[model samples]
Target: MVHTKLKYTPYFSISSFTFIMIRLMLLVCVLVSFAAAIPWLSPAYWLSPRAWPCPEDAAIAPCTCYADDDLNLFMDCQNLDSFQQLVDIFQVDFPFKKFGRLQISNSDLRDTLTAAVFPDGFMFREVIMFSNNFLDVDPDTFLPSKTELTFMEFSDPTPNFPLPAELTQLPELREAVLSVNCSEIPAWASDSLVTLTIRCLQDTEFPSPLNLSHLSALHLHHTNLLGVPVNSFVGSPGLQTLSLNNDQLASFDDGALSFTALHQLDISSNALTTMPQLTCGCEIQWLLGEDDATMPLIGIQNVTLVCDDGSGKFDDIRNVLDQLC
Candidate 1:
C-alpha cells in the first residue's frame, strides 16, 4: 500500500559531494605542509637543490637551515651578530621541528643560550660557537633550562678564551671543545664530561688531575703550558689517551705523568727539553719509532716515550726501557 506514492531520495547531492571533496583536500594539504616543515620528510625534499640537502623554513631571519641526506638539520646563524637577533628570528619564524645542530659564529659577547631567548625549548644534539669576537654569557644562562645538549665546541677570535663567569653544571653535556684563558680548570666545568679538550693560554698545569678522573680522553691544545706540573696526571687513572699538543711546554715535571693504565700519549709540537718519568704499570703507545730522532721519541713494545736529548739519545731511552721494562 505504501508503494502507491514511493519516491527515491537523491543518495548524494552536488553540494554535499563538493563539500566532502574540499574537506579531504584540506586534510591532505595539512599533512603535506606538516611533512614539509620537518625538512627531509617533505615530498619536495628531492626537488630543492642545496648542499647535501635543504631544510625547513630556510627563509627564517638571520639564519640559514640545511638538511643532510641523513635527515639531520643544521641551523647556521653565523650572520647574526647577537643572541638578541636570534631571539628576534624565533619570535617570528620558528621552525616546527627542533634542529639537530646549531652553529653561531661572529656573534656578540652578550649572547647566551637559555629559555628566555628560545622559549619554545632549544633542543640540539650539537652546537658550535666559532670565530666569535666574545662569548659573554651570564651565570647559569648559558644553556637551555629544559633540554639536554650533548656536544658543544667553541673558537674564540679574541685573545682570551672567553670562559663563562659562572659555568653552572650542564648535566647532559658529554663532550666539549672550549677555548679559554684559564690557568686552571674551572670549578664549574662538569665532572660528568667524557671528552675534555681545553684550548687555553695558561702556562700552569691543568686545574687538577684529581678533578678530572672521569675523563677518558684529555687533550690540551694551545694551552701555553710551560710544563705539566709534578703529578699532574696522577689521579687520571681512567684516562685512556692524553694529548698535550700545540703548546709552549718546555718540559714535563719529573714524575709529572703517572697514569695507571694509559693507552696513548701525544706530546707533539711542544718545546719539551726532556720526557717525564712513566710510573710502573703504565701502558705506552709509541707514535714515533726509536730511530725517528727528529721527533725525539722511542718506539717501545707497548709504550710510547718522548725522550729527546736532541743528541740522538733516543736509542739510550729505548735501551733503558728494553733493559728495565
Candidate 2:
C-alpha cells in the first residue's frame, strides 16, 4: 500500500484577490454611471426639483414652468397677447409657488402691473420684463418677493417710466437693468446691490447723487448727460466700473471721480474735449472707442484709446494723465 500525499491549493492568490476587487469596483462604477444617465434609475432624480409635479398645461396656458439645470424652477411666459391672459395664468393654483426665475417678453401687455398679477406668498429670485408697454408698475407688484428677489430687468421706451418704489425694500436685490425714459436714477437703498444699468431711451440727467454703499459697476448709455454733477457718486466708495457711453458729457464736475476704488472709467462716444480728471491712486483704464469701427459690438470689440495729453495712446493711464504715481 502506498501513502498518497496531496498538496493544498488556495482558492485565490493575493493577485487574484486584487483582480477580483478591481473588477467589482469597475462594475460598481459602471452601474453608478448607468443609473445617473437614466433619470428614472437614480435616487437623485427622485429628490430633485424635477420630481415635483408642475401645474397642468391647460392651467398655465401662456406660461410654462420647468426645472433648470441647477434644480431651480423657472417660469417663462412669452408673446402674451393680453394682460387678461396674464391674469388668467396667475389665477391658476400652482403646486409650486417658489420659483427661481420669472420671464415675460414680447407682448402687448400694457398698463399697470399690480400685486394681483402675482399670487400671494409666491416668491421669485429673478424677474425680467422686456419689450412690453407698462406705463405704471405698482410699487407692491413685487412686494411678495422682496426678500427672495435678486435680479430684475425692465425695458421699453415709456416717458416718465415709474421705477418700482418697492425696489428699495428688497434686501436681497443685487442687479437691476432699466431701459426706460426716466429723468434720473432713484436713490436706491439696497446694501446688497452690486450692478446697475440704465439705458435711457431719451435724454436723462443725474439730478441726485448715488448713495449705494456696495455698488461696484454702473452703466449709463444714451442719457445725453451734459456733465457729471458734483457728488454724483460720492456715496459709492466701492464702485469700480463706471461707463457713460453714447451721452453728451463734455466735462465732469469737480471731485466727480474722487472715489478711491474706481478702476475703469469708460466715457466713449461722448463729447469730451479733454480727459476727465482722475483722482484715484489705483491704475485706471479709460476706454476711448472701438478701433476701425464707428460703433462697438456688444460685449465684443477691439477698444481703442487716444491720449488727449499727447502721450499717444499709452497703455498706462497715468501716462495719458501725465500724473506720476
Q: lDDT (CA) for every model shown?
A: 0.60, 0.70
Worst 10 residues of 1 by lDDT: 280-289
Error of 1 at 30 (Å): 12
After superposition on all C-alphas, the RMSD of every candidate to the true structure, in Å, is 7.1, 11.9
Q: List TM-scores for all candidates, in order.
A: 0.63, 0.69
Clashing pairs in 2: none
For 230-310, candidate 2 gives per-residue lDDT tens digits of 777777878878888889987666556565566566677887665444443432322222221312222322322333345
Tens-place lDDT digits, model 1, residues 57-102? 5555557877777777777886666656777766654443466787
Q: Cα lDDT for residue 203, model 2?
A: 60
Q: How many backbone clashes does candidate 2 have?
A: 0
Considering every candidate listed, which one attains the maximal lDDT? 2
